[model samples]
Target chain A: EPEVTQTPSHQVTQMGQEVILRCVPISNHLYFYWYRQILGQKVEFLVSFYNNEISEKSEIFDDQFSVERPDGSNFTLKIRSTKLEDSAMYFCASNAEGDRYEQYFGPGTRLTVT
Target chain B: GESVGLHLPTLSVQEGDNSIINCAYSNSASDYFIWYKQESGKGPQFIIDIRSNMDKRQGQRVTVLLNKTVKHLSLQIAATQPGDSAVYFCAEIGAGGYNKLIFGAGTRLAVHP
Candidate 1:
């Protein structure tokens, strides 16, 4: 079965540095999303992207965060300046246009900021 | 604020037994619900989902029951095996233009052999 895949399974960066988490969602899926989970916390929605634009975003998705679909298959999340609290497991998900309710998640990129 | 929450934080059951995990949602506008299983170091795997128009749905060895009046959802696994051990989360998609998932605090399921 086709599944969502993410790059740099584990990422470590300095507190003030930048990091980009990349994901390649299921090829035919139209909607893409990014979510994060702090250790021992529930997953929180970050943003949703469709048609090369952001559909919705949470308060945590402030100016420091941005998402891009630079290519047909690549969806990326970039953090301009990482904070200690920014360390968490970032997951990328996608669903087909016909089934918007069932989003499939990638293995996730573990972001560690020191 | 609307939120999804689990009834239990952890549940331990013997192998070959049945397991039922429960969830409650405060959002009446949520039209869809899903259950996901996450093993350690992996992402959430889709188990099954039910739409608000229906009260019950079944897939493989699992069944999902939704109570729209109480806003309750439950996932039942029959003849649970050791591999069934994982953290389960109930998620919802509210009625909106953007269908972003809202997850509940997960419930850890442990199966003892």
Candidate 2:
């Protein structure tokens, strides 16, 4: 079965540095999303992207966060400046146009900021 | 604000026994619910889902029961095996434009042989 894949399974960056997390969602899916989970915390929604635009975002997705579909298969989340609190497991998910209820998730990128 | 929560934080069961995990949601507008299994160092894996229109659905050895009146959901695994040990989460998709999933605080399931 086709699954969503993410690059740089583990990323370590200095505080105040910019970082980009990349994901290749399942091909043929129309909607994409990004979520994060702090260690020992529930996963929180970050943002949703469709048609090359952001559909919705949470308070955690402030100005520092941006998502881009630079190519057909690549969906990336860029953090302008990393904070210690930003360190978490970032996950990318996608679903087909007709199946909005079932979103497939990638293995996730563990971001560690020091 | 909407929130999804699990009834228990951890459950331990003997192998070959049945396991049942429960969840409760405060969002009445949530039309769809999904159960996901997340093993250590892995992402959430889709187990099964049920729409608001249905009260029950079954897949493989797992069954999902939804109680719209109480805003509750439960996942039942029959003849649980050692491999069934993992953290289970319940998520919901509210009625809206983007179908972003709102996940619950996960319940850890441990199966002892």
Candidate 3:
């Protein structure tokens, strides 16, 4: 079974530094999404992407966040400046066109900012 | 604002027993619901999903029940095993454009020998 893959399983960065989390979604998937789960909190949606444009984003996804599909296979999320509260598990997900509601998620990248 | 919540924070079950996790969603416009299992340090894995038009759906040893009237969803696992232990979450997707998913807090399932 093909699954979404994320790079840098764990990332540590200094506060005020920039961090880019990378993901390679399933090859055939058309829709991609970014989500974050704070320790001991529910997973929260960050943004959704389709056709190289952001479809929707949450208040949590503010000015500091940006997503890019720089290549056919790579989707990346960049945080302009990291903060202590920015530490969390960031997940990437994708879905085939036929089943838009069912998304396959990657193992996730644990971002730790200090 | 829409919210999804689980009935309990934790559930403990004997190895051979069946386990059921319940969720309540407050989005009437939600047309799709999914159940996901998240082990420690991992992302949510899709288990099963049901549409608003369907009352029930089954896959492998798992079954999902949906009640549109009460806005309730439940995931039942048969012959629960230690490997089945994890934090289970229920997510809902509205009929809106983005197809963003809102997840519940989640229920921690513990299977004991």
Each prediction's TM-score against the native?
A: 0.98, 0.98, 0.98
Give lDDT tens digits, candidate 3, residues A1-114.
Answer: 999999999999999999999999999999999999999989999999999999999999999999999999999999999999999999999999987888999999999999
Cα shift from native, residue B85, model 1 (Å):
0.7
Question: Per-prediction RMSD in angstroms?
Answer: 0.8, 0.9, 0.9
Candidate 2 residue lDDT tens string, A6-111:
9899999999999999999999999999999999888888999998999999889999999999989999999999999999999999999998778899999999
Q: lDDT for each of the candidates?
A: 0.95, 0.94, 0.95
Give the alpha carbon lDDT tens digit for every residue of B1-113 in model 1: 77999999999999999999999999998888999999999999899999999999999999999999999999999999999999999999854578888999999999999
Model 1's CAPRI class is high
lDDT of 2 at A95: 93
What DockQ results for candidate 1? 0.89
**Candidate 1 Cα errors over 4 Å, as ranges:** none
Candidate 1 clashes between residue pairs 3 or more apart in a chain or in different chains: none
Fnat measured on candidate 3: 0.85
Q: Which parts of model 3 have CA positions greater than 4 angstroms off?
A: none
Winner by DockQ: 1
Worst 10 residues of 1 chain A by lDDT: A37-46
Worst 10 residues of 3 chain A by lDDT: A95-104
